[model samples]
Target chain A: MASTKTEGARRKAGRRKKEDKASTADLLLDATSELMVERNSAEVTFADIAEHSGLNPALIRYHFGSKAGLFMALLERDAGGTFHNLETLVAADMPADQKLRHHVFGVIKTYWRYPYMNRLVAALSLESDSEAARFIAERFTRTLSEAQRRILEQGEREGLFRKIDPTLFYFSVIGSCDHLFTARHSLKFAFGVEEIDDDLRIRYSDHVASILLDSVMV
Target chain B: MASTKTEGARRKAGRRKKEDKASTADLLLDATSELMVERNSAEVTFADIAEHSGLNPALIRYHFGSKAGLFMALLERDAGGTFHNLETLVAADMPADQKLRHHVFGVIKTYWRYPYMNRLVAALSLESDSEAARFIAERFTRTLSEAQRRILEQGEREGLFRKIDPTLFYFSVIGSCDHLFTARHSLKFAFGVEEIDDDLRIRYSDHVASILLDSVMV
Candidate 1:
């Protein structure tokens, strides 16, 4: 009976340790995400992250094994959330037009919520030779292609979308929306606007959706 | 006769020195443009640029006065070229449709020729709070807005384009094309492509033109 009680206590202790590690990892990533928004990723250091997270610098090394490892972890965390959201949207039972609109708007909304994501991605995209960068490139492509394939298939079945290359269509839609925000400085200056408010975002989103629907559909 | 020859010699010496300085400045800017393509501006340093340009490190300081000054010179040089091309296209007495198509193709070809320009602009877009960044941002925006205003005026006069917000339309069209290359890695992954080739670029240019024409035309 005493042995049984000790085993139960040990199991609870193990669960607590797991929870602690998870929380610490979350804290580290949260700090990294915040910092990345303010500055370029190349400008960030492990010590900066530790100071921001209020965790020991050594803990980062212990948990992630290195600075690059920590960056990859942050990317994985954000990408996983983004992918999950994408999967849920794609899995819904809706008309292809509605699905496409939702998917595009949803992505724009997600990206806006995390403005640093595009910069982080832009940085990695250029550094394609790195392992972490390659992972991001590959994973994002696979995820997007799968979602695009499904959307295109649905549109084709409904005879709504034209029979052009789905990949090209997808790229156009994404490029239109993503560039507006990533190039915010240039866009704002060119248009004499200060910020991308809610109304403008809605209009921009509608414009992108129209471009995609009008070009792809009959 | 002696006074005339002495004056002529002095004039020649001054011209030689001025030409030397101009050539050295050109060399630094040229090297900077190349370095900026492979790495972000923040990663570039005087030493790297000197090594690439085969000029003394002090030459950059001597010619441009500072790193930021050198960057500005590069920006002015490239922006001047791009703006010149755009102006030439706009000044032509072509119809709205043809003018728009030529302008779109011109921008795409320019981007492809100086791929690093996009990277530099993207970086500037993010770091626009800085003086140097803002200079580039302002020039780019002013150039784009002027082109857009000309296009809109032409479209209105020709009764070809629908009455739409010129700024929003400009942003959408430019965003669509620019983002594709800027986010080339993500697009490549999503489409399972190797690299953006000539055929893909041509298709993209054509498709963007079609979408813009369809959306804006009566």
Candidate 2:
């Protein structure tokens, strides 16, 4: 009976250990996301994360093995879904213009909702020499290329857009949207605006859509 | 003539002092520009500037008076002719489309030449309470608004563009170009490209111009 009880105890202990790990991982990710917005990736430390997440510094080492690992995990969690969602959204059966609109809106929504993710990505791209940057770059490029291909193909079929290289078109559209928000402070300070309101966003979005459609469409 | 010799010596010393100040100021600006690319504005220090610029640390303090002053001087020097040139290029008696094309190309050239300026502006914008950030924001807004007004007046006069709000159009064009380069690292990483080449840039400029013209033109 003692042996059986001991076995049951061991199993229960194992289950609790797994639960503890899962919770710690979740806490670390949440903390990283919060800190990233206020600070650059290079400046972040395990100590700050421990203090914020309420996890021991050793726990980071024990679980993720290092700060870089923790960072990678955070990125994996955030970007994995975003990239997948974008591909699905792009590939869905819809009109080319509608697909383009949805794709742009989806990206804006993702950036708005998880601003920390954008900051982290931006910081990593700027500072990191690791595979993370390469991974992200590859993902962005492939996605953009695919999106351009689809837009061009659709535009050709509908006889709407000019026969311009889709790559240039893609870059222009995406570039405009990213810069507006990234350079928000400059724009606001220069223009004297308080915030980029919904009305303004819509107006901006429609303007882009019109410009792009008008240029490409026959 | 002991008095005459003394006077000559004093004047020579004064000329040397002015030369020293000018050279020191230029060094600080150059150092700041280089460091701004590798490090965020917050991470930069007086020591780093001094070491990088090969000037005395005290000289930076003496000339610029503070880090902010040095940064402002750097921006002023870098962006000196960019805005003025753009205004001149766009304000000429050309068709609205040609003006838009010239403006787009001019911006691309400026950004390509002074890539660090984009980052510096971006970093400033993220600073919530920074006076520098406020200044940049206000200036950019005013610039964009002015551009919008010019485009609208020109387009309307030429009977080329629709009666849409010029501010919205201005935002769209700016957004497309700025985002393309600012988020370039991510885009390049995602796509597996090195640099956006000249051909691509021209295509992008044309595409942006086409879109804007198409949206506005009758």
Candidate 3:
């Protein structure tokens, strides 16, 4: 009983050390995300992030190879859950319509949380000849396209949705999901909506899902 | 008769001189537009514009007052037709469905030609406390929202379309229209589409129009 207790205590101590090391990186990432959301832009500098997190600036380069590397990590951290949830939803044993509604809501919710994500993705992807860009393209962009293709195919097999080109549909659906967040100025200036609260987010999600679902329904 | 001929010749000379002065500004704007499309970005500089147009950099400032002024002028030159066309279409006696399709096609075509307009508009409007930003918010953004409102109202009045929030519809429809051009990198990486050719543009227009029309149909 003494030996067993000793081993359990040692494992707990090791886990604590591991988590402590990981938390620094997590803290930096959280700082960057908060700055991005607060500024509604991806133009935050290393100094800003360092000051925000109260960490040494050198630690950023040590943890992430560069600014782009840091942004890439932020993207992964912010989007990891979204991609996983999407895969599970695509494979879930539910009707296509229900799955689609959930997927639409999921996308809007992701954007709502990380309104700077789409801009970050676009900038990273547009960096010519960067390995980070290629990784994002294949990992994030391709994954999204493939998931969409599968959902459309499954929906067709179930006779719930008519045929539509997945490529065009990608532009249409993702575009619809992204615009409200991207054009916040327009929202405020044109409609007097100064903020995207939970209520507006829910209504926007329903609006997009209903329109797009009707667009593809048989 | 001799005096009349002289007067006519003098008037012709004046007209030629006026055209010569105006064409320089037009040439600079055209060069800027060409550079934007070629680069698929709105980051063109005045030196680049001068180099492309073979005109002095001072001419740009002289004509446009500043870089922002130049971009504002470009937006006006490119989008003036679209706004007028929209107003005319909204006031036309055609059924709402037809009008919607035509509007969709018109918007897609405009983005196709000036793919940088959306980015330009976003930047200008995001410039806080700037008179130009306010002008864009009122002249361009508000104009679009008003036109959409009129269309939806007409559609409901004709009993040909179901009721939907114009504000949400603005996000959905405009977002759908702008995404294809804005996410060109996604097109290449995700779907192997390198360019937005006329064939692709037409087909995309039809897809958006048909799906959107179905969504709003009574």
Candidate 4:
């Protein structure tokens, strides 16, 4: 066991560190995100995180306590960043439609960065009484829904958008983008693509933005 | 151990059987489908399957070989029914838009009846090398995509539809409906709905059908 740990330590030592100088917690979160995308949340393990990040298992325990803790931290980081972007866009001087388009693109880009975030959010929020679920509802879902409502109202006032249910319409917009990355593998298979390259991601955002705006634009 | 097995056997035998009198294999598949919906695919277990169906573990092993096998059988059965419905609609003498509407409703109903089908399909197809993955690709994904293509072409040819990419349009239609059911719990929490009742299901089908047709109907 001592020799095995030493060998593991030596191999980890041989690896180059991240150039951006991400914190240990952030590195662990990124590793968890990658594993979730590959094998999903349920299949991922703490050992997988330790191995994937080449960090000490004790360090992971010290930072996050558990895999669930790490996953929630990841969600808080990504979803909070996305909400911040939406707030910035909403505060911008752009028109309602453009703001809405940018909002949708922002969401797609977030999911693009963390492909498994939607699946994780859905799983965590469903039948869960944890802080993660509450954070998602308050910081992510409700905040985004309210932002969309403001956009919809502004568009209607400006006579640039049709009257639509903000809840349902936002769900449609989100489902459209969320399903793309959440179901990326299947969609790729259905569309006969070997991978979701950058071009396809842009095309998908364009497609979803067009569909959402077309449905409500005057 | 002998006494425990006897107790289990007695309980299993005392449990009332289904009126329709399904075979053990059919019972196993139905039980698995129920569990997948209730708990999603990642959380199900062979013990859970045996407990839910009141069948012996040996019987499950004997019939389906493994839990994954039972899941594939359920997918095949459900996807096959959906395809059958689509084929029937396509062969009907109805107009292209009507056929497309029916197809959309058919998908919504399928997800309603088997709420976890989309999640299961995505999970299974992501990194699976099993026959379940292949069955989903050939029977579920390909069949549905092909049907959508035919409907799109027919609608355009009949002068009732605008030109659209069938792949992306189909993704939106499916994403709209599939998201509602797959993330029913989260959406329920977000929207403050206690449940998605029949009225909501009808409203959903109508909403999806309207959204899809509105995008394409000329």
lDDT of each: 0.73, 0.68, 0.87, 0.76
Give lDDT for model 4: 0.76
Q: Name the lDDT value of residue B52 in candidate 1.
A: 98
Model 1 C-alpha lDDT per residue in residues A138-169, reported as the tens digit of each score: 66656776787788888888888767666666
Error of 3 at A206 (Å): 0.3
The TM-scores of all predictions, comma-separated, are: 0.89, 0.84, 0.89, 0.86
Residue-wise lDDT of candidate 3 within A1-218, one digit each (tens)? Answer: 99999999999999997897699899999999999887766768899999999999998998888887888888888886689889999999998889889988998999999998877887676566477767677877788878888999999999999999999998998889989998887887777889999999999999999998998999
Candidate 3: list runs displaced more than 4 Å.
A1-21, A54-57, B1-21
Give DockQ for candidates 1 onward, in order.
0.54, 0.60, 0.63, 0.35
Report the TM-score of chain B alone for all candidates.
0.83, 0.82, 0.91, 0.85
Ranking by TM-score: 3, 1, 4, 2
A99: Cα error in model 1, Å? 1.8
Per-residue lDDT over B1-218 for candidate 4, one digit per residue giving the tens place of the 0 to 100 score: 99999999887776745323347878988888888877744467789888999988787787777666666777788778677778878878888999988887888889888888887777577545656666776778778878888888888889998888877776677788787777666566677776778887888787777777777788
Cα DockQ of the candidate 4 complex? 0.35
lDDT digits (tens) for residues A46-161 of candidate 4: 88888999988787778877655766778888787677778877778888989888887888888888878777776666535577666677767788889999998989989998
Off by over 4 Å in 1: A1-5, A40-42, A126-130, A187-194, B39-42, B125-130, B186-197
Q: What is the lDDT of candidate 2?
A: 0.68
lDDT of 2 by residue, A1-218 (tens): 99999999999999999998898888988887788655532357889988988888898888776655676677777666677777776677877777777766766655444545544555666555667677556655556567667767886787665677766666676665555565565445666665777776766666666667677677
Worst 10 residues of 4 chain B by lDDT: B13-22
Winner by lDDT between candidate 4 and candidate 3: 3
